[model samples]
Target: MKRREAREKAVQTLFQLDRTEMSIDEAITYIIESPIDPFYERLVKGTVNHKEEIDKTLEDKLEHWSLERLPKIERTVLRLAVYELLFEDEIPHSVVLNEAVELCKRFGDEKSGRFVNGVLSKFEQK
Candidate 1:
């Protein structure tokens, strides 16, 4: 799968992990195909591995909203995007930001895209 599909898969996988009791492997397997894209694997696993740091960073960026107060899918998207911004140096920051907004749009409420965009823009400015 391409990066876009991989990103979508990563978002769903991460969301499943956050909202359910599924293990990382189970979450990935449930969300992705047998030959999982390498990028997708890295996104899910890396995000999980670095979740504490990611959440902390997001907490600092959030204006009025606490990380846990965010909707599940939006919180998942933010975590995944923060992973890319902090770890996946190979991917452009703009791509990470854009893909995150897209994910929120696809899986979250109408305001999700704007919320994600606003949070991600803080990373870009720094």
Candidate 2:
């Protein structure tokens, strides 16, 4: 699968982790056992490892928006994108933002795609 698709899978799994309250080990094991690409597994693990920092960066960029107040899907998408933007130099910022917008359209609330785009755009400008 493509890296973008892999990222989407990671976002979905992270969102699942929030709902299921699965320990990192459990979530990692479940993802490993699934049909996900190995690249995706790596991305998911990296994001989870750096989630605290990523979320904090996200919170700072979002001004009044608390990470907790975001819908789970939107939160996960932002986490995944920010992780990529901050850590994965192989991927361009534009790619991360585009993939996040697509994932929001697919998995988030109706207004969420645009909301995500707006937030991510601000991050890109910095």
Candidate 3:
């Protein structure tokens, strides 16, 4: 499983959390058992554990955009990328940014990729 595929699953997992309010364990089980690749499992675990901080960071960085205003998919993708950039030092910031752009292109609206890129660029500047 490539990182982008894992990121896709992570985005879906985050989106589902809004509706299901499932426990992390349950979420992990669901993601692992589902078609989502094992490589993304770590991302799912990391995102769930630190969602509040991640969300807060996103909100902080996106000065003009409220977290609630963004689409769920876009928000989830951004959250995953932001988490990697802030917490996953092993992965370069550029990798996180590029993968995030790819995810936006695939899963988001027409402007999503650019929006994600701009937000993450702001994150990197800090």
- For model 3, how does the per-residue alpha-carbon lDDT over 1-126 read when each residue is reduced to its tens digit? 777767877777777776576976677667657664656777887887788999898988886789989888788888888888877888888888889888888888669988888889986532
- For model 1, the superposed segments whose C-alpha errors exceed 4 Å read none
Candidate 1 C-alpha lDDT tens digits along 1-126: 889888999988998899578899999888876887889999999999999999999999999999889989889999999999999888888888889888987888769999998999999632
At residue 19, what lDDT does model 3 achieve?
A: 53
User: Candidate 1: which pairs clash?
Assistant: none
Clashes of each: 0, 0, 0
CA lDDT, candidate 2, residue 95: 78
Pick the TM-score winner. 1
**Per-residue error (Å), model 2, residue 126:** 9.3
Give me the displacement of residue 99 in model 2, in angstroms: 0.4
Error of 3 at 16 (Å): 1.1
Q: List ranges where model 2 is wrong by over 4 Å.
A: 28-36, 124-126
- Model 3 segments beyond 4 Å from truth? 34-38
Model 1, clash count?
0
Q: Which prediction has more favorable lDDT, 1 or 2?
A: 1
**Candidate 1: how large is its RMSD?**
1.4
Error (Å) of candidate 1 at residue 84 is 0.4
